[model samples]
Target chain A: MPTKTVAGTTVEVNDEGFFTDPSQWTEEMAPELAEAEGIDTLTDPHWTVIRFMRQEFEEKGTGPTVRALGKTSGVTVKELYQLFPKGPAKIAARVAGIPKPRGCI
Target chain B: MTHRIVILGAGTGGTLAANRLRREYSTDEATITVVDQDDVHVYQPGLLFVPFALARPDDIVRPRQDQLHDHIEYIQSPIEAVEPDADRVHLTDGTVLDFDVLVVATGAALLPEETEGLTGPGWGEKVHTFYTLEGATALRDSLAAFDGGRLVINVVDMPIKCPVAPLEFAFLADWFFTDRKMRDSVDITYVTPLDAAFTKPVAAKRLGGMLAERGIDLVTEFNTGEVDGEGGRLVSYDEREVPFDVAVVIPLHGGQPYVGRSPGLGDALDFVPTDPHTLQSQSRPNVFALGDATNVPASKAGSVTHFEGDVLVENVSRFIAGEELDASYDGHANCFIETGFGKAMLIDFNYDTEPLPGHFPSKVGMPLLKESRANHLGKLMFQWFYWHALLPGRDIPGIGPDMPTTGKRSPESESP
Candidate 1:
């Protein structure tokens, strides 16, 4: 296993062909990895909220709540649902490349 | 023995395959027969740029049969059934064409009616889709006549033709309105079901920034529940409302109608379950499909089709030769996206790769996933290449359907 650092998180890559550690994850990595997973198009508006969440986590050192992220990002809860079908916590976790946040449940 | 090759739908894939195969094989060795309901071959991608008046309607479209080889018989009729086991195609006109090999290129069709109230009261009034030639022309007129209000360019769902088209329309709308000095008057919002203006991350980040720069409103994750024409509102199932004075929507797309008529031909959307690499139909050995008709988890773009065309032509020939099928479609698809204001963005990827920031084909070629003046010129030049080289079954010297690893920046591997 090769251990590396991304966004200041200790990332591990297993021989099972995984590249980086999941803990090193951030919302910024979601769109990039998702496309590698076969997402064809990644347009602009998706970045607006993702970037907002990335900045929030960086400032507070904790994931922002769906309500808080939505408010700051100018995205509504309903709209956020459509944006992240798996829910905000899951999206943030995927982007953050970490486990789902505790309060997300 | 002249082997019979039956093709369904005379669209890009079918027509191109016919021409390519004819050039590769002698007429005496194999006979090609193409079946379709109409003879009109609409250059679908041109539909996106049409509303901007960049493409003349007549130039982008041609008779379906006109592009094929003269030796290939073109039957203008709808397909009623496809017997994959028998390698046969039954037309709506009660004619059944049997073949030693069957190629299903019956591409996708737009079904705006799939969305509730989308086609009802707002049919052509205030709600318009530029996915069709008729819709594009009408929207051009509507846009030209209007002083401006709330103009929304929306995508009803994912997997629509030319994924970046709606955004292009918004960018161009900005240019269009600014040219008229009505840019500030008309609020241009791009409404999409996905989280961002785009589906990928890096590009989405850059594009979102572009939208902000251009003052185009990015309305994300809006799954349209209903188009309330009288109310002039697009309501999501969750009760979010997007009010628009003029809406340009890219509607839900479905597979060819003939797929619905034939058993085991397609899924609910009429897209065939295809081997992601070989472009062979999962149902039968003799049947192969590509482009928008296959549910191969690839972009439904012409570039994908062009690349798939190369793989498909080879696979079809291999099937005829009874050789072991080479499952080798690297899922290479590249597209030139018009970003408006004399520029465009180009992206290249395959099944496992996300479009990375690098030079394409080589460091000398167009920039990948980056907007550049040269890329925009390439986009414009493609129209000439499309009519003269691509359709005529002539291969470009430098370009191949497979994505080139050389001259591209790979995060995974270090330089040798």
Candidate 2:
């Protein structure tokens, strides 16, 4: 088990899986989720989409539309869809370590 | 008695040396013999573009024995080991070939197994490399069928055959998807352990900028630790992860197996340590090395081999004639980077000089240190030059083995 800080979030990862150290639903948790997913290398674009997803989760407590996510991240809907096959709602939410939104199965 | 010259590994360097030496020395004066395990000599540079459908396999491969001249004896056999003290070579069949002069050109090999978990369940399914003929062909099918997802081009380590190849793959991917109308569907990423897109900082900055402009994600300083294929992830040592739908990995490379068999022949990486300037093996004066086998401070590209071949041919001839070997190889290297969208960049430099801005082969010729349509044409035209002029021992009209430093601009002294 390794406890580390990722993108300003304190995360704990043991033999089971990764979780928030403070257990707060925030944008900074994206790096930790990225780390858990084997995505240590993050460009500004990667962080942009990640941070946007977190903000959307915080504001509405739900994942944003793929178009809105792409607009915020300077990517096309297709491009965003390419990065996140299940859509920005699923990937961004997962990467931000936020719980899956309601009505978005 | 004729000068019995024994050449090992009848690939690029071996075949070229044998043919060049044959032209230089008559049959009565010197007898040339080339030894290798297989006769299938691959045009390695073409392998890079194969995955993108830019080149066909047949276009890049040819019979190894057919490339050499008629007088030269091409022995198709695996080398068991080399007895440096006895000035002899032991073949797998137990035949010992004694020679007055020996040339070891047993080039490098791809070792995908060297990287932990690289050859796991994900291999051939989602993970592939274009470095080998089969790997490139496999990737072609994978790329064609991939509707949309993360396509990562990762270079596991450095000292690869062609340093610019991975970048080329990224560039070509952009073009490949664009042609298929799926450019928007695929998210391309270029990952490397280096701090930049290239080894040289200037070229790195330039190429990195190009990667950015092309919407390709550049992930530097990510040393691949383990590949979790089932999970579609690449985990680094620091527990950083880069997930991919399809991962194109250029695995760690090493010198030929024969190098390890020959005691004190190679370093841990299986590369022979030689005087960079002289191209003479550090172990023995009678033995010489060239191409990817030597640990020369240059890109392991064909141009470097062509340049080194000139100096090596001269040095070998000098050594045979009882003359002092001139240690004058300048570590010259030149490469034409194929940046997709019908464009390419040309860079020429030596040990002391970095790739600077200006014209190449003289101020009146091709663009240097800059990408241009003309340079792209030059790159495409090189395949013909490689076969007709370069390989068959026929010299190019103006270009010499040593890099021409005159017309190239200095890094510090910027030209307007």
Top-lDDT candidate index: 2
The lDDT values for all models are: 0.76, 0.79
Interface DockQ of candidate 2: 0.01
How large is the i-RMS for each model, in angstroms? 14.2, 20.3
TM-score of predicted chain B, candidate 1: 0.96
Tens digits of per-residue lDDT for model 1, B195-260 = 787877666877889899999889887777688877888987567899999998888777887787
TM-score of every model?
Answer: 0.80, 0.79
How many clashes (backbone N, Cα, C below 3 Å) per candidate?
Answer: 25, 6
Model 2 C-alpha RMSD to native: 15.0
Tens-place lDDT digits, model 2, residues B167-253: 988988998898888889899999987768887867777889999998999998676767777899897655679999999998977
Worst 10 residues of 1 chain B by lDDT: B407-416
Which residue pairs of candidate 2 clash? Answer: A38-B241, A38-B242, A39-B241, A39-B242, A40-B240, A40-B241
lDDT of 2 at A26: 57
**Model 1: per-residue Cα lDDT at residue A37:** 34
lDDT of 2 at B398: 78
- What TM-score does model 2 achieve against the real structure? 0.79
